[model samples]
Target: MGKITGFMEYERLQEASEEPQKRLKHYKEFTLHLNDADAKIQGARCMDCGIPFCNNGCPVNNIIPDWNDLVFHGDYQTALDTLHSTNNFPEFTGRICPAPCEAACTLGINEDPVGIKSIEHFIIDKGWENGWVKPQPAVVKTGKKVAVVGSGPAGMAAAQQLARVGHDVTVFEKNDRVGGLLRYGIPDFKMEKSHIDLRVKQMEAEGVTFRTGVFIGKDFPADIINWAKETISADQLNKDFDAVILTGGAEQPRDLPVPGRELKGVHYAMEFLPVQNKVNAGDKVKDQIMATGKHVIVIGGGDTGSDCVGTSNRHGAESVIQFELLPQPPEEENKPLVWPYWPTKLRTSSSHEEGCERDWAVATKRLEGKNGKVEKLIAARVEWKDGKMVEVPNSEFEMKADLVLLAMGFVSPVQSVLDAFGIEKDGRGNAKATTDGEGCYRTSVDKVFAAGDMRRGQSLVVWAIREGRQCAREVDAFLMGDSVLPR
Candidate 1:
């Protein structure tokens, strides 16, 4: 540790950002990173705890203390290297990951946690600015070839690792562009797409090929998802590639099937979020769903719901309200009881700061509409009794809602892809695959592996990267009878 008593001397500092009103006008990232001196101060706050629980808390197990010490000593290049050792895309996690590491901080039992995420953001951005990040193309070419189906974080991480190990890798994406979810599902105001594009370029230089607008499954209708422009059969991929990894996202949106569910203005959060991304990318979208001047109601209280609130505010909506079925958590967690673990506590996102009315323990009963468009929402207060929701007596209410967005989260991956390949599925409809033992990450079908959302169900981007890296190792060993890649 660079400063033995630094944790006692320094308090945590957060990254600065634009005023919500000012930032609401444009679809660009608003949060700013910490400068060098501020970052060093933050790094110095890392305590000399014997066991680094923050590492275990992080999904990728980042070498947090090593990087913190390096940053405190002004050895930022080594800090960047240490940061990249376990995580393939720190920039993505730095921006979007809900840092469980902070929750598990040793100092956080009483004091503020170290600003680890901000330090990471600074380190990676510095690496980019100094051109330290480069293509690491393998010198010796292994004859093995791999097919990674999905260009999200998991697929990208797998492809990069395998390519660096001298294996020929190709990534297939059904969308017009790469970055399956990051390209479309995410709003630009949080993270710009250029980050994904830059990585794609680097991967290409490292001998990883990307095929966009190519669906490796049965044909879908023109109205469904990114609508496969071309189809590649699973049989063809099995024959061509030595191994295949399924890293596609969970895209099956959970639907709200109450009365008047088919109203024109009511849509899934995916149906609304992706249109703005496409428009931002200079592509013309058909019949775009906008929140401008409409009274909006977003259901489900999660990151996706928060995203809807932020996007709706940006669209100049008349009003935006979000509903949560669960009871509101306490404002702060009981640290003594939940230390070194993720705790259930109230968290308000930057989007909530921008403005959105939020209510908990409220469930939508039905939607009322006129002229084939939603006009209002009918809901009621709910109470948990004996582990079940029971509506409060005579607590029914109505609110004006010109548009409704269902942000209830995904159910599973689109079943068509799994069905086309005849891969077995878990009870939850995710790809059936183990995460440990001799056959880890290998699907029931030979030479076919699954990882990320496709295998483990919907999860954070950090988990996706971890699974991708590990799956790459398994696939490598399967092809060559051994592997030097890290687990």
Candidate 2:
């Protein structure tokens, strides 16, 4: 530990954020990074716990304490190195990850946890400003070609690792740009697209080829959401590339199968989110879904729902209301019972802080509309008894809703790609692959592998990176009989 008694001396300090009113005017990152001194103090708060659960708590198993000590000692470059060792994109995780590491921090049992995410954001931003982040191209070529389908965090990480290890890696994306979800699904207000651009540039310099607007499947039907200019068959990819890794994320959104779900104003969160991101990137979106001056109802209380709330507020919605099917959790978690683990408690995101009427334990019965457009939502109070949810008697209610955004989360990956490749699917419809044992990440078909949401279902960016790195290692070993890449 850099400072033995620092945890006792310093209270947790978070990064400053812009006022909601001021920040709502533009689509840009509003949270300011912590200054060096404050970051050092926050880093110094890391106690010398016998076991660093924060490391395991992090999906990518980030080397937390080491970087904290480095930051405390003013070793910024070393801190960046340590931070990047396990996690390929600390900037992404620093910005969007919920920081399970902090929840499992030793000090968090009794006091505020060490501000690990803030310190990480500081280190990465400083690294970029100082020109510390650069291309790390391999000196020798392996002459083996690997195709990574999907250019999201997982695909990007796998391609980078494979390229760095002297293998030819080509990333295929169905969108107009390299970043799959990061470029479209995420709003610029949370994290500007420039971060993804910088990483794309770095990867390109590292000898990784990015083929955007290229769909990897047998057919590119007009019914699909792919904006690809060309289509490559799965058979052709298998023959051309020595190995193929499917890192495509789960895109099949869960739908609310209720009356009037086909109404004009009802749409999936994805349908609404991507348009705004495309508009932010200077692309013209036709008939884009907007919440302007409309009473918006966001169903499903999760990150996606919160994002809808923020976006709707930004669009000058008359009002925004979020609904949750489950009962409300306690504002504060029972720390004694869930210490060193992710606790079940109410989490208020910055979007919620912006302004939203949130309700829990409510189930939507149906949507009523006028002339095929949503006008009102019919809902009922639900009570959980003996692990079953039952509707309360005569508790039916209705609310005005000109727009409804379904944010209940993704159910599975787009099945067309999986079917085209003849890959086996799990019970959940995700690409079936084991994380351990022989032939790890290997799909039912030969020379085919799966990872990230494609294999494990919808998950965090950090987890996607982890799966990508491990899958890359598995692919490398499958090719060369050995790999130096970390798992």
Q: What lDDT does the true structure give each of the candidates?
A: 0.92, 0.93
Error of 1 at 327 (Å): 0.5
Candidate 1, superposed: residue stretches over 4 Å from native: 219-224
The lDDT, on a scale of 0 to 1, for candidate 1 is 0.92
Residue-wise C-alpha lDDT for candidate 1, range 1-487, written one tens digit per residue: 9899999999899999999999999999999999989998999999969999999999899999999999999999999999989998989998988998988889888999998889889999999999999999999999899999999999999999999999999999998999988888889998899999989999999999999999987855333477457899999999999999999998889889899898889899998998899999999888999999999999999999999999999999999999999999999999999999999999999999999999999999999988898999999999999999999999999999999999999999878888889999999999999999989999888899999999999999999999999999999999999999999
Each candidate's number of clashing pairs is 0, 0
Question: TM-score for model 1?
Answer: 0.99
Candidate 2, residue 350: how far the Cα is off, in Å? 0.7
Could you tell me how far off, in angstroms, the CA of residue 352 lies in candidate 1 after the best superposition? Answer: 0.7
